[model samples]
Target: MQDKIYFIELNEDKKYEDYKQYHSLLPLEKQQKIHKFRYDIDKKLSLIADLFIRFLICQNLKLNNKEITFEKNPFGKPYLLGNPEFHFNISHTRNAIAIGISGNPIGVDIEKIKCADLKIAKRFFSSNELEYILTNKEDSFFYEIWTKKEAYIKWDGRGLSIPLDSFDVTGGPIDKMLRMVTIHGYIISVCSRQDFNGAWCMELAEDSVPVCLQKIL
Candidate 1:
C-alpha cells in the first residue's frame, strides 16, 4: 500500500484575477459555494484552499468527481464514504494546507504562528511541557510545541474537546502510536493505526496556484 503525505502552501493574498482563474477551474458546486460567499474573503480563501486539495487528490488518484463523497464525523472530522481501504486527513492554516494519505488511518494539522501568548499554554500543555517551554525562552519554539499537541489531538478524532494536557509527546521517532515534530515554523504531528517509522515528508511551495479537483479514495 502507498503511504504518502503531501503538503501544499498557498499565499492567501491572491489577486482578483488569480482568484478568477482559479475559480473558473473549480467544480460547479464549489463555484456556487464560492459565489455564495463573495463578500466574505476569509470564507472564500478557505473554499479555494479546499478545492485545491481536492484537485490534487483527484489528479493523484485518477478518480472522477462523481465518485467522491464526503461525510463528517459527529465531531465534524471529514472522511470518505464507501471507501475504507484508503485513509486521509487534512489541515490548513491561514497560509498553508496539508494532506496526509496512507493505507493506515492518519491525521494532519497546520497552524500559522501569530501573536498568541505563551501564558495560555498551561491550559493545554502538561506541567512538564510548560516547564520545558519556560526553560526554552522562545516564543516560536513554544508555538511549535502547541501546534504539535493540537495536531495530535485532532488526529485522535476527539478534537480539542479532549483535555489538551492529557498526554505528552517526547521528541523522538514516532512509534506505533503518536509522534510530533517541528517543521519550518510549523508544528506537525501525526497519529496512525500503526507505527510510522521512517516516514518522509514533502513540502510544497507556498505560492503554488490552486487547481480544481476532488477525489473519492
Candidate 2:
C-alpha cells in the first residue's frame, strides 16, 4: 500500500463528553496513560494520536479494534503486534495530531510554526542544517528541517539512540525520501522508502475520522 498521512486540528473547547467518547475507544492501558496527564490538552493529544492510528489500521485490515495489539522494536518504535510488516508512526504538536501508515516502514512529525530557536537548532542540527536554516530568512525553514530530521530518525526506528547531529538532512539521500507540507500554521514531514510522489497528506476534521475509513474500505 502507498504511504498515507492524516492529521487533525483539535478544538481546544471540545466537549468533555466528546473526549470521553473517544477516550473509551482506546485500550485500557492507553486510557490509563491518558488519564495520568495533568492537563486536558495533554490528554487530548495523547488520546487522538493513539486513536487516529488504531482506527486507521483497524479499518485497513478489517479487524476489530479491540483485537489489534502493538509491540515495540528493540529501539522502542511501535508496530502492530501480529502484522509485523505493516509500519506506522504518530506525532502531535500542541493542537494538531498526525499519523503515517504504510506497508513499509514510515515516520511522521508535525510541529506548530513558531519563532525559530537558534540555540536549540545549534545543539541538535548538523552544521549543514544549521547553515541552511540560517541562510533562509523565513522561520518555516527551521521547522521544515527540524521535522525532516525528526521524521528521518523515526523512519530509521533507532530513535534518539542515534544522534540528531550525526547526519545531514539538507541535501543528502535522506532528503530524497522526505515529503513535507505546511497547513494552518503547522509544518508536517513524512519519511518513507517509497518515492515522494503522490503520497497523500490530508487534513482531517475532528468529526471526519470515519470518512477516511469509508474511503479506504
Candidate 3:
C-alpha cells in the first residue's frame, strides 16, 4: 500500500469546548488521558492526535472504530492491537500535528520554525550535522535536520534511547529513506523503511477535519 502522511493545522481560535465534541470517539483510557492535560491546547492536541490516527486506521483497514484498539511498545510507540503489518507514527508542535501510516514502518515529525539555538544543536547533534547547520547558518536548516533526527529516532522505534548524535541525517544511505518539506513556517520530515516518493506530505485543511472524524465518530 502507498504510504499516507498528513498534517492538520490547529485552529487556535477554536476553544477546547469545540473540540470536546469529539470526545465520544475516544476510548475511556484516551478520554481520561485528555482530561489530565492542564491547558486547552494540550487537551486538543491529545484529543485530535488520538482520534485522527484512529480515523485513519479505520479507513485503511475497513474496520469499525469500536474494533480498533491501541497498545504501546516498551519505548512508547503505539501500534494497532491486531494489525502487525500496519505501522504509523505521530508528532505535534504548537500548531500542527502530523501522522504517517504505511504497511511498512513509518515515522513523521512536524515543528514550528523558531530561532535556532546552536547550543542545543551542539548538545544533541552529531559533529557532521552541527557543521552543516553552522556552515549554512540558517534556522530553516537547523529545523530541517532537527525534524529528520526526531523522525529518524521515532522511525527507529527506540525513541530517545538511541542518541541523536549517533546518526547523521545528512546525505547518505539513510538520507535516501527520508523526505522533508517546509510549510507555513513549519518544517516536516518523514522517514520510511523504503524510500519516499513525490509529495508524500499532505496538508489537511481545518474544514476537512469533521469529514474525517465522521468516518469513525
Candidate 4:
C-alpha cells in the first residue's frame, strides 16, 4: 500500500464559524454532556474540533452514514474502532491543525510559536540540543526545537507524560520523508511509517475544498 500523509491548515476565523455549525449538528444531550465547561466559547470550540475531525475521517474513509467510533489505547492514544489496519493522528494549536494518515501507525503535531522563556529548553532537550540552540544565536530557535520534540512525543503515543529529553533527534534530518512546514507563525510536522519522498505542503484555505478519498490506504 502507498502511505502518504496530507497536511490541512485551518483558517482560525473560519474554524470558529465551522465550530458554530458543528454545535448545531450535535444532539442537545450530547452537547451538554461534552460541554461541561462554564465558558460557552470553550465548550463550542471543543465540540467543533471533535466534529471537524470526525467529518474528516468519515470523508477520508468514504463511509456512507456509518458513524466512526474511536477507541482509546491504554496509554490514552485514540484509534479507530475495528479498523486497526488504518492508522491516524491529529494535533492542533491555537491557529493551526494537522491530520496524519497511514496504512500503519502515524503521529502528527502542530504548534503556534509564542513567547516562552528560553530556560524551559533545559527541561525537555538534551544537553547537546540545548548547546546547539545556544550556538544557533537566535532566541526563537528554542520554540522550533520544542515543537519538533513535542511532535515526536505525540508520534510516540505517550503524549506529554513522556520526558521530552529522553529521545534525541539531533542527527542529520530527523526523517527522510518527514515534512516540516510553517504558516501564520506556526510549525507543523507529520511522521509516518511510509516515506513521503516528494510531498508538498497544502493549506486549508477558506475557499479551498476537501478531497474525497476512494478508500483508506
Candidate 5:
C-alpha cells in the first residue's frame, strides 16, 4: 500500500493515562469492549484500533472527538455516517495499528511474522493458491496470501460469511488492487478500488503533530 493507508505505532510503555484518555473518546460500547480484555496486549490493541480511527476521522474531517459518529452496515462493516463519501478500515497487530481511507471501499490488515499452520491453509486456500504457497517462500508466502485474503474479505465487508476457500489468492480481479508493505518485519496489505497510494508513516499516538514517519519500509 502506498498512500491511502495511514499507520500509527504506539509505545506500550507510554503513559497509560494517554491511552485511557483516547479510549474514553470512543463510544461507550467500544470502551466497554476494551475494558473487558483480560490481557494488556489485547486491551491496548483494541484501544489503539479505536484511537486510530478516531484520530484519522478527526484530522480529515476537522471534527472534534465527540463530533465523530459511526454506524456499521448490516454485515457489521463500520463506516462514517455523516460523510458517506469516505470509506475506511482498521487493523491491529500486537504492537502497531493501521487505518485506511479512500473515496471508495477499502480494507487493510497487518500480521506479525510468525509460525505457520499449513494445515489451516490447506483447508482454506484453493488448490492453485496452495500450490503457490507450497512451492514458494513458505512462511512468507503463506502470510502474503493470508494478509491478502484478509484484506479482500474486509473489503468485501461480509466478514467470514464468505468462504475463504472459494476465492483464488494467487491472483484475481481482487488481487489487482491489493498491495503489500513490509514494515518492522510485519506484513501489511491493503485493498482499494483504485491503485493504492497509502501514506505510511510512524505516527505515534502521543505525537500531537502529524509528520511523515521515517524508518518504515
Candidate 6:
C-alpha cells in the first residue's frame, strides 16, 4: 500500500460561501467546530480541513464518506478509529491543508514561510537545530526545521510533553523516514515509519476541495 499526501489550498481572498457544497457532507461535530471560529478564514479552513481529510479517507480506504470515524490518542493526535490499518494526520496553515496517509503511523505539517522571531528557535530547538536555522538566515530554512519538528512530534503521538530540545532532529533515527517538500510558498514536512523516498505531490484543491474530489480519486 502506498502512502499518500493530499493538498488543499484556501487562499485569503476566497470566501467560505464558495465552498458551501462541502458543508452538507461534514458531520455535526465538524460543522460545529467550523462555526466555532470567529473569523471567516478560520471557519473556511476548519470546514475545508475536516471535509478534505474525510474525503481522502473515503477514497483511500474505499469506504463511504459517512463511514469514516476518528479517535484521538491521549495526547490529542487523531487516528482512524474504525479502520486502524489506515493511519492519517492533518495540518492546516494560513493557506493550505495537508493530509498524510499510510498503513503505518504517520504525521504531516505545512507552514507558510514567513519572518518570525528567531529567539523561538533558541528556546525549543536543539543546539544543532538552532545552529542550522541561525546559520542559514533564510525563512524557508527556519520553516523547514520547524515543520520537521512539528511533524515528528505528531508522529510520536505525544504532544508537547516531549520537549523539543531533548531530541536530535538534524540526524533522525534510521528506521523512520523524514521528508520535506515545497507547496506554493509553504514548507511541508512529514514523518512516518514506512520507507518514503520523498515522492509526494501538492496540487491546489481550490474549487475542487468539496465538489471535484470524487473525480480526483
Estimate every model's Cα lDDT from 0 to 1.
Answer: 0.63, 0.83, 0.87, 0.61, 0.74, 0.79
- Summed over model 3, clashes come to 0
Question: Taking the tens digit of each residue's C-alpha lDDT, what string does model 4 give over 42-156?
Answer: 4543554455555656666765424566778878888988777778777765545566667767777677766756678777688877887888866556666776776666667
Best by lDDT: 3
| Model 5 Cα lDDT, one tens digit per residue, 41-116 | 7787776676666766766776677777889988898998889777999888877777788778888888877887
On the 0 to 100 scale, the lDDT of residue 148 in model 4 is 70
Per-residue CA lDDT of model 3 for 93-171, tens digit only, reads 8878898998888778899999998899999999999999999988999999999999888888899999888899997
Off by more than 4 A, model 3: none
Question: What is the lDDT, from 0 to 100, of the residue 73 in candidate 2?
Answer: 90
Q: Candidate 4 has which clashing residue pairs, if any?
A: none
Worst 10 residues of 6 by lDDT: 208-217
Q: Residue by residue across 133-159, what tens digits does model 1's lDDT show? A: 888887765776676676666667778
Selected candidate, larger TM-score, 3 vs 6 = 3
Q: Which lDDT tens digits does candidate 6 get at residues 1-217?
A: 5787777777676798777666777778778878888988888877777777777777777778767677888999988877878888889987688888888888788999889578889898889888888888787888888888888888889967999888867885921468888877988888887766556655765776646455323
Q: Estimate each model's TM-score.
A: 0.75, 0.92, 0.96, 0.76, 0.87, 0.91
lDDT of model 5, residue 72: 92
Alpha carbon deviation, residue 208, candidate 3 (Å) = 1.5
Count the clashes in each prediction.
3, 0, 0, 0, 7, 0
User: Per-residue lDDT of 1-217 in model 2, one digit per residue for the tens?
Assistant: 5568888998876743465655656778888888898888888778768877877787778777777788899999999998876789999989899898888889899999999888989999999999998898689999999899999999999988989999988787999889899999999998998765564887888777545434322
Better of 1 and 5 by TM-score: 5
lDDT of 1: 0.63
Rank by lDDT, descending? 3, 2, 6, 5, 1, 4
